[model samples]
Every structure is written in structure tokens, then in C-alpha cells.
Target: MMRIWPVFRRELVGYFATPLAYVFIVIFLFAMGASTFYLGNFYEGRTANLERFFLFHPWLYLFLMPALAMRLWAEEKKTGTIEILMTLPIPAWASVMGKFLAAWAFSGIALALTFPMWITVNILGEPDNGVILASYIGSFFMAGGYLAIGSCLSAATNNQVIAFVVSIVVCFLFTVSGLPLVLQVAQAVLPTPVVSAIASFSFLTRFEAIAEGVIDLRDVIYFASLILLWLGINVALLERARAG
Candidate 1:
């Protein structure tokens, strides 16, 4: 943990040093507002809650998170700085954790910027602030899951575009695994228990539970486990690159 701070600080600070950070935040905010107001019919419903706001997060992350994560290790490798990073005394796992945490923190900052939406809902009517808070937590965790997958893929290739596209494809699978259409197909060929297991693995399933103010321990565990699993893969990939 101690060794992780320098890398964490470096990467976190590096984000603000470039225009990429500002552009990403602007795009993310605009996309969320547009989706909520237009596609989600936020004003038409005249609802007090942010159901429409949080509903689009998984879809938004499909594109946004990968774009943010595509630079994690891809740019390093592209510029030959990865060799320098690997030669440092820090263990590969520390470096991986550090980088992942930085990306996650940046995402948390972007998510926090959506507070005006929360405030708007409150001004419109008496919204259930508890559920809104839980949804924010769920969204943050879901972003971490997306970033973890993207981080691992970014480590696998030097091309940022490849990293972004592949991450979206993989994340899309996890996002839709619980949908009725997917389950119907699985149910036809797979047993009930097997199909149920597939549903449990879906990001939408876990996140929806938490978003609804359920905050189930299982949902939290699922996100944590998924993030850790992908980060472990990320570390292994970095270690392999260092060894070679």
C-alpha cells in the first residue's frame, strides 16, 4: 500500500496536466444530461427520483469508461515509458493497483460532478435521497468494474483504439447478460440453475439491486470480486511484459 502512493499520485496528477481530463469530464456530463432529459423523458415523467438518470449509466460507461481507461498502459507502452515504469522497485501489483485506483478516483470525481442532477430532482420534488445516494454508490462501483476490465485490456495492447473497442465489446457482454432476451436463449439450451448463474454474473443485475436502495452484500461483493479479478489479470499482464 505504501509503495502504491507515488504511482497513484503521479497518475492522478498526470490526468489534470492534459486536456484529455477536461474533455472527458465535459463529454461525460453532456452525455448524462442528454440521455436523462431526452432519451429518459426526465421532465415528462415529472418524477422526484433519479431513476432515469442512473438508468443510462451502464450504457454510458460502455463507451466512456473504456475511453478513459484506454490510455492507462497503452500510452506507456506506445511511448516506451512502460519499460521505465517496470524497472522501478515497485512490484507490478502495486503499480497495477495504483493505476487502477487513479482511474477509479478520476471516475468518482466525474460522477460526483453530477450532483446538480441530484439537486435538481430535490428542487422539483421531495425525492428519496437515500436511494439517490445508493444509486451513486452503485454507479461508482460499476464504473470501477468497467475500468478494471479496460485496464487489463489496455495492458494487453499498445494501441489505445484497440484497447477502447475491445473493452467496450467485453463490457457489453457483462452488461447485457441478465437481459430477458439473453436469458431466454440461455434457458432453451441451458438448465435452469445454469441460466440463473449467468444472470447473477450480469453487471446490470448487481447494479440494479444497489441502485434500487437494496444495497445487498452480495451485490457489493460481486462488484468487488469482479474488480479484483480483472485487476489481478492486469497485474499478471504487466508482470509478463516486464519479464519479457
Candidate 2:
């Protein structure tokens, strides 16, 4: 835990040391606002729920989170600093957890900056603040899920673009897994129970539960386990890369 902090601090500071982090934050803020008002029809809805605002999060993170995570290990490998990082006294798991937490914190910052949307909903009328809070929590976990997937892909290659593209594709599959059309296709080839289980793995399904203020233990566990699983894979892959 103590060791993780140094890596976390280093990586977090590294983000702002360049224009990449600033550019990402600016675009992310703009996109969230544009999506809330334009695509979300915030004014037309006339509702104070902020449901329209949170609705686009999974899709938004599909691209944005990958861009944030693509450089996690890709930049390290590209510059051949990965060896230096690995040879440090810290455990690989600590480094892995630290890097992931750094990216996740950065994502949380972007999400938190959208507080204006929340404030607008409050100003408009009465709203379920509980549901809004729950949605924010769910959105953070969803972003973690996206980042974990991107981290694994980034570790697999030294190309940030490849990491971004592949993360989008994989995240898209998880996003659509619970859709009616996708479920229908799965049902045709799989048993009823199998189809149900597969749909349970969908990020949208888990996120929607919390978005509605459910906060089920199962939903939280799914995302927590996902982050752990993929990040474990990330550490193992990095070790293999180091050995080679």
C-alpha cells in the first residue's frame, strides 16, 4: 500500500507534465457538455433527473478512457523505461495497482468536473439526488472497467493507437452484450441460462442498476473483480515482457 503511493504519485504527476493530459481534459469536458445539452436534449427534457446526462457515459468512456489508458505502459515501453520501472524495489502488483488507480483517479476528476450538469438539474427542479449520486459511483466503476481493459491491451503492445482502437472494440462488445439484438443472437446458439449469464457480464447492465440507485452488491463485485482480473493479467504480461 505504501509502495503503491509513490507509483501513483509519479504517474499522476506525469499526466500534467505534458500537454496530452490537458488536451484530454479539455476535450472530455467539452464533449460531456455538448453531449448533455445537444445529444441529451437537456433543455427539451425539462426534467431535473440528469438521466439524459448520465446516459451517454458508457459510450463516452469507450473512447476517452482508452485514450487516457493507452499510454500507461505503451509510453514506458516505447521509451524503454519499463525495465527501470520493473527493477524498482516495489512489487509488480503494487506498480500495477498504482498505475490503475492513477488513471482511475484522473477519470474520476473528469467526471467530477461535470458537476455543472448536476447543479443545473438541481436548479431546474426537484431531483433524486440519491440516484444521481449512485449513477456517478456506477460511472466511475464503469470507467475503471474500461481502463482495466485498456491497460491489458496497452501492455500487449507499445503502440498507443493500437491500444486505443482495440480497447474501443472490446469495450463496445461489453457495452452491447445486454442489448435485445445481441441477446437474441446469443439465445439462438446458447442455452437460456447461458444467455442470461452472459448478459449479466454486460457493463451496461451493471451500470444501469446503480444508475437507478440499486447499488447491488453483485454489480459492484462484477466491476471490482474485472479490474482485479485484467490488472492481474497486465502484471503477468509485463513480467513476461521483461523476461523476454
Candidate 3:
């Protein structure tokens, strides 16, 4: 934790040192608000819940998370500063976790700033705030999962565009894994257990479970494991990249 702080602090500030942070926040806010009001029929539906708001997150993060993750390692390589940073007196794990945590925290900030929507709902009528809070929690974990994936994919190449493309493709596959259409295809050839396994990997399934106030331990564990698994891959990829 001690060794990771400086890197975390540096990376977090780096986000805001330019217009990228503001741009990201603005885009996120616009997407959320527009999706809720237009596609979700926020006014027409007489409800105080943010169900419509949260529902669009998986699709929203599909494009956004990769954009955030594409620069983590890709920019380091592009500018040739990765060599200096890699040789510093820091554990590779520390570097990996620090960068990832910084990115995750940035994601959390973006999510938190959407609280106005929550506030708007409360003013209109009584809604279960607990469910809204749980949805926020689930969304952050899901963002971490997406960012970790982006981190690993970014490490595999120095091209940010390529990193972004690969991360989108991978995240999309995970998001659709549990959909009826995907399940239908998997069950056609795969065994029952294999089909079930594919369904378990679905981000939408686990996220919806939490968003609906079903805070089961299994759903939480699934997101945690997803983040850890991809982050471990991130560490391994960075180690190899540093060596080469």
C-alpha cells in the first residue's frame, strides 16, 4: 500500500491535468442523462427509482471503459517512459494495482457525480434508496472489471486504438454471455455444464441481480473475481512487456 500511493496519486492527477478528465465526466453525464430521459422515458414512467438510469450502464461503459484503459500502459510505451518507470524501486504488483486503483477511483468519481439523478428521484417520490446504493456499488465493480480488462489489453500493444478496439470486443462478449440469444447458441453444441459456465460469466446477469437489490454474496464474488482475474493478467502482461 505504501509503495503504491505515489503512483496512484500521480495517475489520478494525470487524469485531471488535461481536459481528458472533464471530457470524460461530461460525456458520461450526458450519456446517462440522455439515456434516462429519452430512451428510458423517465418522465412518462411514474417512478422514483433509477432503474432506467442504471440500466444503460453496461452499454455506456462498453465504449467508455476502454477509452479510459487504453492509455494506462499504451501511453507509457508511446512516450517511452515505461522503461524508466519499470526500473524504479517498486514492486511490479504495486505498480499494477496502483494504476488500476487510480483508474477505478476515477471511474467511481464519475459514477458518484451522477448522484443528482438519485436526488431528483427522491424529490419526486419515495424510492428504495438502498437499491439505488447497491446499484452504484455494483456499477463500480463492473467498471473495475472493464478497466482491468482494458489494462491487460493495453499492455499487449502500444497502440491505444488497438487496445481500445480489443477491449471493446472482449467486454462486449462478456456482456452478452448470458443473454437468451447467446445461451441458445451455446446450448446447441456445448454440454449443459458448459452452457451454464458461459452464463455465469455474463456481466449483465450479475449486475442486474445486484441492481434489483438482490445483494447475494455470489454476485459480489463474481465481480470481485472478474476484476482480480483481469488485473492478474495485467500484472503478467506488464512484467513481460517490461522485460522485452
- Each candidate's number of clashing pairs is 0, 0, 0
lDDT (C-alpha) at residue 235 in model 1: 90
lDDT of 2 by residue, 59-130 (tens): 899899999999999988899888888989999899989999999999998889989888888888999999
Cα-lDDT of candidate 2: 0.92
> lDDT of all predictions, in order shown?
0.95, 0.92, 0.92
Every candidate's CA RMSD: 0.8, 1.0, 0.8
lDDT of 1 by residue, 1-244 (tens): 7999999999999999999899999999999999999999999997899999999999999999999899999999999998888889999999999999999999999999999999998899999999998999999999999999999999999999999999999999999999999999999999999999999999999889999988888898999999999999999888787678
Q: In model 1, how large is the Cα lDDT of residue 164?
A: 98
Clash pairs, model 3 backbone: none
lDDT for each residue of candidate 3 in 183-240, tens digit (9 for 90 to 100): 9998999999999999999999999999998788998898888888998988888877
**What TM value does model 1 have?**
0.98
TM-score (all chains, Cα) for each model: 0.98, 0.97, 0.98
In candidate 2, which residue ranges exceed 4 Å CA deviation? Answer: none
Error of 1 at 79 (Å): 0.8
